[model samples]
Target chain A: MAHEHDPPLDPVFKSSLRELKWIIVIWLVHFVWVLGYCSTYGYLTPETPLITVIGMPSWVFWGVFVPWIAATLVSSWFALTQIEDHALPDASPLPEKSEADEKGGADHE
Target chain B: MNEGSTAALLTFAGYTISVFALAILSNRVGKGKDFVGEYFLGSRSFGVWAFALTFAATNASGGSFTGFPALIYTHGWTLALWIAAYMVMPLVSMALIGKRMNQIARKTNALTIPEVLRARFESPAVGLVATSLLIFFMFFYLLAQFKAGGIILSTLFADEPLFQSAVSFVSQTTVNIPWVNQAEPDYLVCLIIFAAAVIIYVVYGGFRAVVWTDVMQGIVMFVGVILMLGMALWQVGGLDNATRKLEQMIPPEHGSAILSTGTVVATDQTFAKGTWLFDTGKVFRLGELAIIREGQSSTVPVKILKITTPFEVEGLNAKRISGQIPDPGLTVRVTDPKPYKYGAGQTGNYVRNPGPDSGNDVGFLAIGTAISFFIFWPFAATGQPSNMVRLLSFKDTRTLRYSIVTVAIYYSIIYFALIIIFCCARVLMPGMEIAPDQTMPAFAAQLTRDAGIPWLAGLLVAAPFAAVMSSVDSFLLVVSSAVVRDIYQQHVDRQAPEKMIKILSYSVTVIVGVLAVLCVLNPPQYLQDLIVFATGGLAACFLIPMVLSLYWPRMTANATIAAMLGGTGMHLGLTCWGYIADKEFRAYSFLGVNPFIWDLIGSLVIALIVIAVGPKPNRDLVLKFFHDTTSDGS
Candidate 1:
């Protein structure tokens, strides 16, 4: 439980905000990467030869398929390595086992 | 039932029974915990597997399985860009507020989003408003899920004699009922069965059951997609071959036509909807069954197809294709065959950026719409109350961290694999546009049969079925919580007895589930559209307010309420304007951007302005939410 006299902006809250900034940055980067590449090369002229990379069209391979793989890696790194884990505050204990609490099968299987 | 249908039905029945068993086990697990918290929040304890799968499964609803595949099959490769934003959905949706909100909920011991808000501000009004908005949006969401469930079942059992008899009985029984009679007989029969099964399991099992089944369903979805991908790739030869075929393929044209049986004395042959037709070496698909009874004509819709590519034609011809063949003595004519407005008689459109559209010239996913979807997927996910509830249940931050990465990888695989599998579906099963939403299941049966294991179709169809069930259970629980915890317990009787609360919870779940089914008896036309509307509405109502409440210590109750109302008003107002303009249930996009973007902007601006003008939050509230109050003795 936080107190009135304690200083504002605890370590947990500050770290959360910092993590939020990084997450937003990641979102923006991927958004631009996918949109820019896809929109630029997705529309093609009939005379232009259809380019294939691996199995997918060059634009789709680079724009969506590849970025999707990269995103998984980047997100994994961020979640596992960058973000900090803090203990959550425990829930306030229930009233010392009222008669209703003592009799528990009301919510049946 | 045919051998294939029997196998599929048995597999589906086994899956459903497994789900019920999990529900029973979950109920047993709830024996000793606090009744309200255990049933509603799973005692706020979820490990990585449970948390990750539930979050992913709930988010990947019936739309992901049915609507997404349909779009890919209809529009071609552009859906890749349309849904590309999913790459960052995990980090953005989970990392943004998962930690902060979880911490807040723990401190307050809040079991619901509305409860969290009410406790944060000490305002009953806030809780009431939140509850009202949640139930409103989620009710519509539940309706869409029910409809999806019915549709999947109907498609699975279309060839079953027992199922056909049940449909006939249902149709005859409800023929006089105004709304019920309007629904398709198969859909109506399946809807009742789906509704009964879901309501019983969810009401009995509670949140833990929902989570347990979600884990199983999630795995089913993943395995189903991987298998389908393997079969599709194998059947289509390889990815390179499929893409090459797509490049040469031309988009089909849809139009209305009148089919006439000649005046000759010949028996009338019937052409079923979704069956292939041959006319002048060009292939066509019947949009509706044309039964020419005794020298009469039937006006029906048809899709004109041009499959000149010898490679695809060979595959089609190898199947010993079955379609109606008119007698040589009978004269037949098709009138008013409309050509595609865009990309008519053109090749290579399927592999291009915007892809091809039957109606729109700029393509199915224009630049503006593409950008809108890029923003829509991740951020919209963040604002969902169902996702928020899952975030609150993790055992610890480590679980959260691991779950985020798991979901990111999970979505990347499922989405990318689906796009590949369905794109290959175009080559294997051409002319699915007659019933596009059935593409996933229909293609699954076809692929499995081709692989000489028709029984596997059951497991594949269960993927979409599981998706619908997972979503339905979560939404059902959410609505029940809102009613029982937020409304009845908090406002009606804060000290309601445990037995009463339990009974009320069960009753509410059943009632809400039944109401949603009844509402969907005459189902909506587009599943994806309804999902978009409900999700967008909820995000609009809760996202900004909840985010500000968690981060800004000075955020006032007045501002939170204002932001919620303003966002809801903006979203609905724009949707209404869209309906009037287009005469359809779609949102009006200003400047080509979706209504969600504008609604979110308006919501943020409103919240900030209100926070600036309104008085600060109560000092005690700030200390409770923000400061380290453990050090300062109250």
Candidate 2:
């Protein structure tokens, strides 16, 4: 069952778990805030209008804009973290020598 | 300037600005080696959140906003229950499909969904079948989005044909076609918008860029829908006022009979006499004289119905009680049918019109709201090439999970608000029946006319273009990756230079863009229906094999291949036959019995049977794939 191609797991599983915990906590905080705001301030139908925010209404601000901004921030944070954690490491790995190199350089040359 | 011209100008400008912005962003970010791999698969490192957002963005597409709303308006709110299927999808995807697929994909370095199939089954035929199905279905789905975009454009800029003209001119000039200019300006404009956005992103950034942009666009879409909904509600006074007006427009009696059917009761038994079985306490009383006799007629019900000691009244004492029976249990009186005009001589006649303005269609709204809440939320995550790339791009799973949870909450709110607003629009424009495809845009236009909020209307119109273009760009990246990476470099010439891959990518992007444009030119009457048909087919064909291969040790390669072929073949056969056959044979009901449901069911059944009937796979290999307890401990 063992395969040589199987990737090695870094011993950082614990730290990774810790980092995930922080992310979930922050996300939960924001989620709660959004839910509270939507429940309290959201205009369920068109007839129950709220005051304007930058020519847009309060319902728009709370229901749409607020959640959007929160999601963007969270997503951006995740993206930045991902670039740091995953892509950077893999990109920097030593480029494997091809068959041409083993045969003493390019055959065409 | 006319509303059409203004809207067109805004739409064209918005798309141009966004695309340019995306291009600059991609250029600033270094283009890595393994361009196809890095760009399309994000090197296969996508965590939960980015994966979720990218998935969400892909699923949201043009149909979510325009098509679904139009359906809600047409069918009434009861149809919204169909969306309940969505909530279950994510749980199924994450627990059943996504985690396993991620494992296999990472292990095999499989770039596409089809690649995963190939690796699992070790069958080229399986790969080909899966790839062909993916391409075929995705193309139809993409075309639906294109059509949606076109409809939005036509409605938003009804008068000015400038954007449409530009699209036609560009299509003709680039592809050497003289006849496309004669097509509808809406279709032309949508085609050009999609072509430009997709070509640039796929050509430059590849998959990485597409995924990143999906995350961004997903955020924009979530916000845009919400803002549109809020603005809509504001125009109709407010929620309370809108509800009141809706009540005035549609009486309670006119509400959906199907919903009320759940509340009906037979009035036969003595204990239940005069009382609706569904509403027990109000209609019949056990101790009191509940029924009254008319003239010389016998007093029907003076009974001790069931209040502990059941008994019946006899003789003179059973005489009918006169006058007001205090709180005579609520009688759900079934009213007569009221006929309403629909499309071209079609009349929607309801048997029990609750009242002149009973908002019965609210059931549709409720159902739509529920659908938007769950199933639609997860849809934002499926079959997106750019999203897969983004997930692959992620540095770790932690970031991905965070991104998913955030996007999920964001999606939930935005969709809920949008559905509410559309339901509100139903009340505001009771008799307004623009084309189903143009429902949301027409509503926006009406708001502009009624409320003088051109800016808001313009934004609403632009939203679909943004949503559709984002999806189209992701699809372009996918199609291009398949050609450049999977087919050309990998299969045709393994030693092909990076330059060739880049060239192939760009060339494929352009070609696909052209094809997409051609498809959009001959648009379907219902873009939403087209999208569902395509995505449902994909889900049926891929869902089981992808999941079982990753998770179940018993899923043999033969079973996997069989499931895929069986699912895809049955789906296509049934769908084609349904579409082509005569009316009676057409098993294309909207909810209870439809081609999509049939396809999904067929695929699930065949896939299960194959798994059970076929020989078991190497259990140890399956476990290694699923439960490899290793982490890059760096």
TM-scores, one per candidate: 0.94, 0.65
Give me the candidate number with maximum DockQ. 1
TM match of model 1 to true structure: 0.94
Every candidate's lDDT: 0.84, 0.52
lDDT by residue (B1-634, candidate 2, tens digit) is: 6754576577567756766677667655645555656666666555555566767777677777776776555543222233423322322233223333454566666677776666554544556666777777778766766666666655565566565566567666656555565566555765565566567766666665666677767766766677667667887777655443333232111111111222324442222222211233212223222332222222232322111111111111122233223333333332232333221111121100111112233323332243233333333234333343344444554555555555546555655566566657766654233245567777877776667666566666666666776777777766766666556643467677777776777787888777877866766565555666666667667666665655454666666666767767776677666677633323343353445445555665776786666555554444344333554421
Leading candidate by TM-score: 1
Error of 1 at B200 (Å): 0.7
Clashes of each: 5, 63
> lDDT at B283 for candidate 1?
52
- CAPRI verdict (incorrect, acceptable, medium, high) for model 2: incorrect
Q: Can you tell me which runs of candidate 2 are displaced by over 4 Å?
A: A1-109, B2-11, B44-52, B84-95, B161-182, B248-393, B448-451, B524-529, B580-601, B608-620, B627-634
